[model samples]
Target: MARNSYTIGIVLIGVAIILLLGKLGVIHFIASFFWPLVLLIPGLLFHMLFFNRTLPSGVLVPGGILTTYALMFFYCNLFGWGAMSYLWPGFILGVAIGLYELHLFDRNTHRGVWIAAMILGAISVVFFVITLLFKLGVYVIALVLVLAGAALIFRRPRSW
Candidate 1:
């Protein structure tokens, strides 16, 4: 009877706390901002399981993908969704990351997987560079022009 009462008390207390936090909007706030933990938690769990020898290397594929996507989502949530325009390459990078992890961990993985990973990684990098260049090209051109003009003006004549 005592054990039963103790368990009931604990359950009631937990319920009360949960209700209070929900009423205070804490639950809403956490759910809104930290939803990526849903993805990250499972991704990390998959990794932990594989590392602990509870699962196989194949789990790492989804683990890597989910972890990368969760991180990308968190970044967007913290900064702004507008940044997604520049970060679109991260989607391809996530797939590449997963493939690379599979290739690294799975001894039986085919060479095609590695080649695909490399191709995807290269594509992601190229897209990232192109986006960055498009965004910062004007500033780069301006800086180069200023530097060239300054160098021309400051050059010293050779002594004859």
Candidate 2:
């Protein structure tokens, strides 16, 4: 229980830090390639060191992959990398992760991870669909998805 709380706190702190960096416009100047690599390294290390005991290795691998893609997308957007093409890569990675979680990972925790990934993957799909259907409004869909994700994370049961 304590470890779960610590993990949740760390995740929230990480999110807060990213938001703060964005608000300060520090993320805008960072190179598009750098943020994903930077986030991937520490994210993998932290998963290995702190979360390994709680999360399965298979789940961790895909989770880290998704995180890397997400960081890449964020960095691309912040640095104005033109039309947000990185989102496609991120969505692909997310769907791959979800499939891996659903098929390859046979663990007690697989259900939760798979469900979460599916929800996120659906949101990503929706964003892309909306962008295709009406190019100017996709950002609003993404924002809504982010808020929903944040709320889900914040309200997640600690006992699990």
Candidate 3:
């Protein structure tokens, strides 16, 4: 239809202008500040493709990984690189989450693999949280007290 063609043409021209502006540094916000979008776009594209069935479910692994890592990098950029030491495990956990998602979506998935992925993802998070807490100077004594309290609350005493 003529109307649809006109709309498409207008969109193309808009894209051309934006690209030109980016090239000319007239859109410094895109070139400098929104760089994380580079990672985010493809990561989201991967998921969209998977959901649309354009790509196999296996793609979820990389998609989740890229998206999570991009998020982590964005977070680090906002805070500081020093947090990376504590947050490094999150990278692996992100992939694990993706793998888990793949397993959930794929009927032919091997349960063992997905179970391992979930376990690994959990380990990554737990390890990082403990590390972060320690780095923040949560005392060993405090941890011991908390653990002892939890044990007392959860475990019933045996009758003699």
TM-scores for all predictions: 0.83, 0.38, 0.66
lDDT of candidate 1 over 60-143, digit per residue (tens)? 888998999999999999999999989999999988998999999887999999999999999999999999889888998899
Per-residue lDDT over 58-118 for candidate 2, one digit per residue giving the tens place of the 0 to 100 score? 5455555656565765667567776565256465555556455444445555566676666
Candidate 2 accuracy as lDDT: 0.64
TM-score of 1: 0.83
Error of 3 at 9 (Å): 20
Q: In order, what lDDT does every prediction score?
A: 0.93, 0.64, 0.85
Clashes of each: 0, 0, 0
Question: What overall lDDT, based on C-alpha atoms, would model 3 receive against the true structure?
Answer: 0.85
- Candidates sorted by lDDT, best first: 1, 3, 2
Clashes by residue pair, model 3: none
Q: Which residue runs of candidate 1 sit more than 4 Å off their true CA positions? A: 1-10, 150-160
Better of 2 and 3 by TM-score: 3
Q: Which 10-residue span in candidate 3 carries the lowest summed lDDT?
A: 29-38
TM-score of 3: 0.66
